[model samples]
Target chain A: MTGLPMVVSAANLPARVRIHEVGARDGLQNEKTTVPTEVKAEFVRRLADAGLTTIEATSFVHPKWVPQLADAEQLFPLIADLRGVHLPVLVPNERGLDRALSLSATRVAVFASATESFAKANLNRTVDEALAMFEPVLARAKAEGVHVRGYLSMCFGDPWEGEVPVPQVVRVCKALLDMGCDELSLGDTIGVATPGHVTALLTALEEAGIPAAAVGVHFHDTYGQALANTYAALEHGVTTIDASAGGLGGCPYAKSATGNLATEDLVWMLQGLGIDTGVDLGRLVATSAWMAGQLGRPSPSRTVRALSHKEQ
Target chain B: MTGLPMVVSAANLPARVRIHEVGARDGLQNEKTTVPTEVKAEFVRRLADAGLTTIEATSFVHPKWVPQLADAEQLFPLIADLRGVHLPVLVPNERGLDRALSLSATRVAVFASATESFAKANLNRTVDEALAMFEPVLARAKAEGVHVRGYLSMCFGDPWEGEVPVPQVVRVCKALLDMGCDELSLGDTIGVATPGHVTALLTALEEAGIPAAAVGVHFHDTYGQALANTYAALEHGVTTIDASAGGLGGCPYAKSATGNLATEDLVWMLQGLGIDTGVDLGRLVATSAWMAGQLGRPSPSRTVRALSHKEQ
Candidate 1:
């Protein structure tokens, strides 16, 4: 029993969704073990083969910041030949942007914090300073004929500051879009968001003249609200969803807790809704199972666990 | 940080949801360990203290079928003193109903399967035969002036049956309502349902004259679809939700997998939506923590894992 969900479509949702697969870049960055360069390249290839079009390949951040993804230069060229697949890499600043450009990367993304506390804590700068820092990177990427994506972290709530105001998040989003970035991915960094808060943020963005087409949602499963929040986002007409394969991101505090929405889980919901994602569920599960075996642990995905059990 | 989700209410949802906590009966019934009668009593008391108005205490089925809760006669008397809380016990047939009525139980429920495969597998009887068997039980309970809840399992998809039809589920629901049931709890026993399927079934139930107020949703989390399906049910105006404390039910094949939706996770979502559930989140977390300790394992709930870590 492959154990797929039965199809039943709802009204007002997009017939097709472009899943922004972030397993290699976002998922493995938080891992305790550093995977080899060959495995990382193979992972990107497998994700492409599974029919994920927009796969975030890796980060060009300083090795000191994310040592796990330090093999970006060695890993990119290995999977760069994947035709018809959009491999988006994260570029922290102009230095990282230069590195991605050197490799002929066509798509790049820069992450910014919505709240001041996270800006200071994560990037050692204020909100404006962080945006100012990404200015040159986005400008250079746009000049180089590369698509740019802006990731707005802490859109829902921040750990240091309890509940984030929707207006405050909207300001950062507008600044990012104005700074030469093409689209924005709203990140619930700590996974503290609920459906209404998700709706509130998306509605606020709409009021600020941002359409749902240019927005993607990145939700963590820290509190098990990711899928429900994703459903709410879809209801608001946001089609691009960011998910990590096998729910790869793990909480540093609790190893058992998942830090990202599992891609397999998302595909199950989409498949059941009769929405086309173009990703083969069987191949995706197999890829996650292989990746989980490499990490010497089980994937934090319920769909993976449930389906993989039947195959065995 | 207690890691509580910030409140942001959704539109057109119920102002308050009735949480039918089923930790003591449905949750513990799956465990291989036999919890003592005193511990079960204390668990019920603690759940009441945590502000759960309706707790499914224990089942009145034969000791041979459910050895874990065979001491229902003893357990019921111990917690009957708790005021202002509704304790619903499951009664399988006439014998089980007789046991429940003799114990002076105010509320009783009968479990049925919506699919023929599950009906044959679980009860060793056809769907019609199973319904006929419950006729006398439901009638006797009604005559005793007790509230009857009809539980229809495999409401969405069954493992052996794949996808259960919306019409098929509605037929059983109508049968239950006609046979003296005050309400129906639709159970997605395999956790394979998606949002559209949930809405479709709810719509069919309404067309069959079963109002949302007369329906509760019981979802498993095997494929991580419970919370998302729950949101869909909420959108369709269903107010009563069934959850297990500490996510007590575990998949026998995969211990890491959760078989029931966690009450803490559901509470976090409800509280974030400003939906009044009369539940104290802090106390509920502590109660689940203590229950997890009694079971000699960490809770499978992400909310339990996230919050309990901060407390420690």
Candidate 2:
């Protein structure tokens, strides 16, 4: 009662939990004002310092479309200089992949939509057409010995299409995996997907012979189902999860989209489950606090905000 | 394109879900200004109209402790008049029991804590002492044949004493069951409990011969683990859940305690799982909005607050 007290209830936990940090690409992409390249670099450096092994450095999308990540070239080199960090970049098309390759990117991810309508709206192509485009990109990346992560957006529901069929999502996932993508990230672009949807989809995916380890889940907090969906994936043995630091990012297309799953909240959850993500909770909360200060906004991550206030 | 705007991926849901509405008790307990008895009765009536079957009407404690529910006697009669509604009142002592009995209460609940420190601090007595006090109240209530609900506080973790042992929670649960309590509500008291702890505790309780049907979970969203913990509880077949409408209410006894689980958010999760709680989502959101307007503050339920903003 006098000093900081320690109460030990017998401790037991999962051996490992992988957190694929999405702040650089997803977090910054949704910001109203573009962050400077130097700030982005520093954010990546701080993330590394906070023990993030998989830090998404930036995206190679067109500047006209996503101006927030215009300095992807400059930021990649900054993160590439950091030790023991796996810096991955988002590639939208052939041009994006070319830029990523020109930068000697060892790891690059290509994002397309699961539903045809979302593919057209978000990527300006039909689902088959997007897959057709990603085909050559993946083949070239594979030939170059670069790791390719394929992201299937709007897997659960689509803005224009309403409810997307699970089989359609499974079809897209199969095409991406067959195209030699090392991993697939199923996205609930609007954050409307629930645990039941996640459970059903993942079960379907597994039925299609897709290894659980080959999948990651990207969730939005629009409907407040992101964390629940993430836990559903974790329960099914998903090793990779996409979360943004400080709960930054949202889909421009999804009207209710607010923020991504907060890295601090996810870590708080995993740590309680005794899943080691090799990240420090105090340091992670501090980084989120700093970024929240810079953005002049509170983090959507409840644990980070709570801890920061408590510390104050 | 115009017809039913097809949703191809709707969740394959479980048929039925039981909603234990704690709004009247938990929702009003945290407000700085005491709401009038007429307003409380009207609120209970509205919730029942919205199809909340089990509504916690008010607490029968001394007004000196909980000034918010000073008019329990006044509120009970009005609530009891609502047709097809099950009104449950909290009885902290024999005097409280007598008050509830005077109103011909259909259901009465007793409160106790699993942790010794919380039991002593919150109730000003030891765990055994509190149980002994409940014995006479239980005997009188049983003679009258009123349904008794037992609230096992600090079942997961205690603020004063950090991690609660599962056996302690199990023992308290057993004592309540042995005392002829119809249902046992496990109160998180402080919101520091995680899903893992909840799973472990529920598993232990079930292992100790307590049927899942006899158990209910009351969670606080302080640490943002409330919903996840609730889901974990759901997986163990817990039907009845205690939630505050609009995520209102906090324990004044526990410093830094936050509101109970938001009824709106919990309904969203349940409905998404295809579990029918017999409560309308839009109606629940509207009720929270009306309450928030009266309070001159935002609703604590994330789904309610978010959806209300979108509606605007």
Candidate 3:
């Protein structure tokens, strides 16, 4: 009947949460079509207009690896003029870090794997070897006085390895934070996690002296557990949540789902709980609906579909 | 990677949960096309075989009201021989109750609205008038040694009315429980509730002397808050959850969603938490997939979609 959600605040959650918007990078990477440079640039600008401050602009990987974002150089420059926003670029290695630095990208993130299977499959290196690779990148970024985020994939599960051990994840998270990285993002890449696993990981990290404040959660809605997992993380005092605009990363209908949690869905829950995310829900929905038209499919976010349909 | 969720139990949760399956009744009533009586019977039989103990088979309302389930009398007898299952049919009034009692239905439910707006719209009676109407029905069911469940709709939000008050809901719940209903199912008709609002309501109910054990939760996924809200209810010691097989009631693609929480999605979370539901995930997925084929569309359940794709 209507588009908006009724606000009813929950307790023991952070007063304000900082959403790390990843629609332009992670979302497009999994898309079937390669979005144009101008459209991608406009997406970042629109995301900022929707009040998303930390929009992940694009990844600085090699063209052969991520051909979709080959225009990282061109894309970054177009949105570089956007003020009051922190644009973080994914830096795969020292060379990727060099490319980001070349564009004057002030924030960069290094991707690591909590499990060995993901490390070898994704980076062609073992967990320790990948950590060794990021050492130079993080050190250089720290030396350059740039903000750095370390993303640990397969924190809860791995394809080759079913359930990753909490202690194993804790060791890798410790290594990243102990190194020159400023913060960490726990990735439920396969989205097999429940609330207990999330609480266990966060508790382990806390015991290892990593405060929940320094960590962000990146959950995939593969099993419809992303929002529930987000609620658990929020209760544990996490301040950062990574979301894709329009749930753009992977289509849920596909067998191999890279379904990042939808940003609009996350905003709806946060706003209902009275947790301020500094996001304008209406503008965000409009941006996602517009992007869905560009992609030639309906936006997967229920809130986006519900609201946009009413306007139509 | 795989279809199954990794089991990791959270503490302080109930050891087992009893799911009240509503696919045959709540799910199909909102469908654009009406299902045949034989198919509806087979659906209930399949649900029982898949390990759902309590199934809401159909409503005894008049055909003019819900033409989709006009064959309740013809449908109930076909599955009455199925053993060890409770088939609950909705009895709208004295006529509905008489029809259900003729079929030897041991369990029946009466629907009431927590808000005046819904009471007027759905029942054509005010809140107290609706309850007054059920007074005779509850007494009759009690006299017949039948179990009665009181369903309080619009407990969270209303379309015409934005946010519902917690006290108003508790007062209605107490009325139903005090009258003769053994238990209550609180409905989030619009699905606008946050986790905090859920906890606040349950706490309020507990303060009113309604133990968490005597209540169940029914959540809709209109804004995708169902699972997270379910988790909140579980934390508060709720043991009964109402779900629809294949998420039958409403299509998320439709603008006006009557999306019931998918049974498979709930099983995924409950199974991952190492909680016993006695449900076979593979069989349940197959059942929902088969039902989706009957409905000429895919199931809205993310787990059902993800798991069935792997089997293909």
Q: What is the DockQ of each candidate?
A: 0.70, 0.30, 0.61
Docking class of 3: medium
| Docking level for model 2 | acceptable
Better of 1 and 2 by TM-score: 1
DockQ of 3: 0.61
What TM-score would every model get versus the actual structure? 0.98, 0.91, 0.98
Q: Is candidate 2 or candidate 3 better by TM-score?
A: 3
DockQ agreement of candidate 1 with the native complex: 0.70
| Ordered list by TM-score, greatest first | 1, 3, 2
lDDT of each: 0.91, 0.80, 0.90
- What TM-score does structure 3 among the candidates reach? 0.98
Interface RMSD of each: 1.8, 5.4, 2.1
Fnat per predicted structure, each in turn: 0.73, 0.21, 0.57
Positional deviation of residue A117's Cα in model 2 after best superposition, in angstroms = 2.4
Task: Report per-candidate TM-score of chain A alone.
Answer: 0.98, 0.93, 0.98
Candidate 3 CA-lDDT value: 0.90
